[model samples]
Target: MNPGRPATGGSTTTAVLGALAGAVLLVMVLVVAFPDWFAPYPPERTDLRAVLEGPSAAHPLGTDQLGRDVLSRLVDGARLSVLIAAAATAVGVLGGALIGLLSAAAGTRVDSLLMRAVDVLLAFPELLLALLVVAVLGSGAVNTALAIGIAAIPNYARLVRGQALVVLRSDYVEAARMLGVAPARYLVRHVLPNVSGPVVVLASIGTGTALITASGLSLFGLGPRPPQADWGAMVADGKDFLQLAWWVSVTPGAAIVLVVVVMTLVGRGLQMRVLR
Candidate 1:
């Protein structure tokens, strides 16, 4: 290959993954935004006569134990997955940013106190922290979101704090300080905007993490109640029937894996682009 020519293999792989991720995310968004448009039957509608039936023309993904259309339930489940992920990501990002900014802006005593608390929280694995919170709040979609969001906060808080410290030490910050700029105005206008890029990247990655945590919680019976179509719950529902009907559990599990992998790839791509 000519020295001037860009390597084809690595870039080609990244491009392919990006395209795949984008296509998956687009489908997910379409399903979540308009589930009724994609679903052939009401997700809750049951046909007991057809229970555990294999895939056929009428039901492309087959039927669950209750004879509910697996395809329709999967489409409906997309709504819950996307909603919880979005909500939890927003909560984690916004709350973490505020805490991080506060830690950086405050005096040494306050900064020390806040960072120590964050460190303590970070000591635990994200799932364990989420499970602890869910145990206290009780199981439900809202609680699941809150639990995952709270678990996610420490990561963002530490990330933002590090960025904030760097921005605070920059020459423009020094210049602003010299010019007698008010502390509040200086931090808000100069500090935050500069540090926000990294925070955005972190939030993008954290969204996938939040989704996984939420789904795991649901699988463990800590999310929305039964009969509601949830991907995690669907997988749980089919666990015992895996030997007889694999599609019921496998389809939803595959969806979760696809979503998480795509999100991570996209987030990594965005991070690389941002860094460049």
Candidate 2:
């Protein structure tokens, strides 16, 4: 057995999940990087005669109520979804990590105060919190990103703080403190690196959550305005035509589900690897 490989029993399962996730990730990346090249028709172009058509040679995935190519929209939707998720996760990870580091380093009234504030924020359900933020900030891609990012911060902050506290007790951390290392240097050089693995895993998982949240917001008419080709907006537009053009809503919904499921599996795999 290869020393680096997992045991045979669970390895097959992991491999299958990993393969599925890798395929989804590849499709998502390709769509975002070259949407026009992959799309069969312009996402915004409409053909009234083609509206509600089922899958065919001309339109593999069929056409929506607006006669826009379903496949093209789906592909472009991947780009939007992935971009929003990545941006929100990046914001959450950086903001949360900084807040966590500060909370741990302060170690007194400041720590208590910050954690209490986080607790207050965490008291609301994530979706509710996101809704509140979006309502306050008004809807758009930027606001959606910010709302999702803020909603995710408490989770990352708590995880980072726990990890940082444990790292602070380690021998190396003690040595650094005894050597009179500046608090900033100690956190940057020691605490942050040691606590980063779990944070990374959490951020990956949070990306899936962010994507789902953004989609939900869009579907509810609180995201980017129409004609922008967002997956949620696509689903919303297809709702009225469900009897005739189910593919519009169904396809985008499936895309969202597939992306989130794959991301979750990948995140779990990373966590398992980290634990090992």
Whole-model lDDT values for every prediction: 0.89, 0.88
- Across 1-276, the per-residue lDDT of candidate 2 in tens digits comes to 898976787888898889889888887788899988889998888999988899999999899887889999888877877888899999889889989999988979989999999999999987788899999999988888898899989998998999999999999999998999998999999999989999988887888889889999998898877678888898898899888778878999888898889888889989988999
Q: Which residue runs does candidate 1 get wrong by more than 4 Å?
A: none
Residue 180 displacement in candidate 2 (angstroms): 1.6
Pairs in clash, predicted candidate 1: none
Work out the TM-score per prediction.
0.95, 0.95
Query: Each prediction's Cα RMSD?
Result: 1.4, 2.7
lDDT of 2: 0.88
* Candidate 2 off by > 4 Å: 1-7
- Summed backbone clashes in each candidate are 0, 0
Candidate 1 accuracy as lDDT? 0.89
